[model samples]
Target: MKEERVKKILSLLEKAYPDAKLVLHYNNPLELLIATILAAQCTDERVNKVTETLFKKCKTAQDYASAEQDVFEQEIRSTGFYKNKAKNIIACGKELVERFDGKVPDTMEDLVTLPGVGRKTASVLLGNIFGKQAVAVDTHVFRVSHRLELAKANDPDKVEQELCKIIPQEKWTRSCLVVGTHGRRTCIARKPLCNVCVVEKLCHSPDKIYSSRQE
Candidate 1:
């Protein structure tokens, strides 16, 4: 991708979603960490619904560590893959209490070491909590990046690597957030609303409809 086109797309995204923020609600990094875990293979709405009550009971790493596995699994059953999620969450909580003084780690290396925390989740924490420059390639980001021709890779890791090489370092987090926002609102997975998209003219997606632009 050309630097000029990338900058233009970014500028349009910022303008379109000036107030874009993480859809997952959380009071702290720990809550966000757990929420992100529940969010895997689940919608944000479902995760939020589960967390609304779950967070009230489990306020800290120690709380989760002490939670009974069966009970915890029942609590988050709506999020899908409850067994694995519960096990991972409890293990991660215990790890946090044992290491890092019960606080979520700021660095990617440390964060990814936790159970259920992968590069995507770690990037979200780093960007939102630690104010670090990291790109989180979720489903939305992956599709949007490919649709925009900003990344040609199938895997999230490779796509993130490709983006980091082109997108300015400081704008990594913002780019992810805004592009994700666009993906959710306009450039959706099933049927994109290309005609209403602000970057329609700039987009080169073969899936694009009602736009004169072509790659």
Candidate 2:
């Protein structure tokens, strides 16, 4: 997709959802990290609901590291994949305490080394917590990018690279948040409300059910 067109789409999205932001609720970087891990195959709403109690119980790296496996699993059970998430959360806490002195690493290299922490999670921490320009290519981002032709690759890493090439560095974080929101609100996977989409005219995805331009 052309840079100019991408910019225009972004402009429209910005106007449409000026308040679009990361929906996951977190009090600190560690909470956000844990929430992101739980959010892998779950909704942010579910993660937030689970974290409401989880955070109160596990406030620090040591808390998670020392938590009972079965008990911890039950706490995050509603997030799904609780067994792995529990194991990873405990292991991630140990890594943070042992390697990083119980602090969440701001760099991608260190962050990805933690259990359950991937590029997408790292990008979220980098942009939101560390105030760095990073694009988190989650499910919503991946789908929206492909449909918008902002990226042609199937692999998320390639898509991220493609998006970085086209989207300005300053708008990287905002683009991810806006486009992800668009995917949820307008360009939904099952039933996209194309007629109400702010960027409907700019999008030419074959999957679009209705086009305002056609009207």
Query: Best-fitting candidate, measured by lDDT?
Result: 1
lDDT of 2 at 146: 90
**98-215 per-residue lDDT for model 1 (tens digits):** 9988999899999999999999999999998889999999999999999999999999999999999989999999999999999999999989999899998887788986785543
Q: What's the lDDT for candidate 1?
A: 0.93
Off by over 4 Å in 1: 212-215
What's each prediction's TM-score?
Answer: 0.96, 0.97
The candidate that wins on TM-score is 2
Q: What is the lDDT of residue 7 in candidate 1?
A: 95
Residue 176 of candidate 2: its Cα lDDT? 95
- With a 3 Å backbone cut-off (N, CA, C), the pairs that clash in candidate 1 are none
Worst 10 residues of 2 by lDDT: 206-215
Query: Model 2, residue 149: what's the lDDT?
Result: 89
What total of clashing residue pairs does each candidate reach? 0, 0
Off by over 4 Å in 2: none
Error of 2 at 82 (Å): 1.1
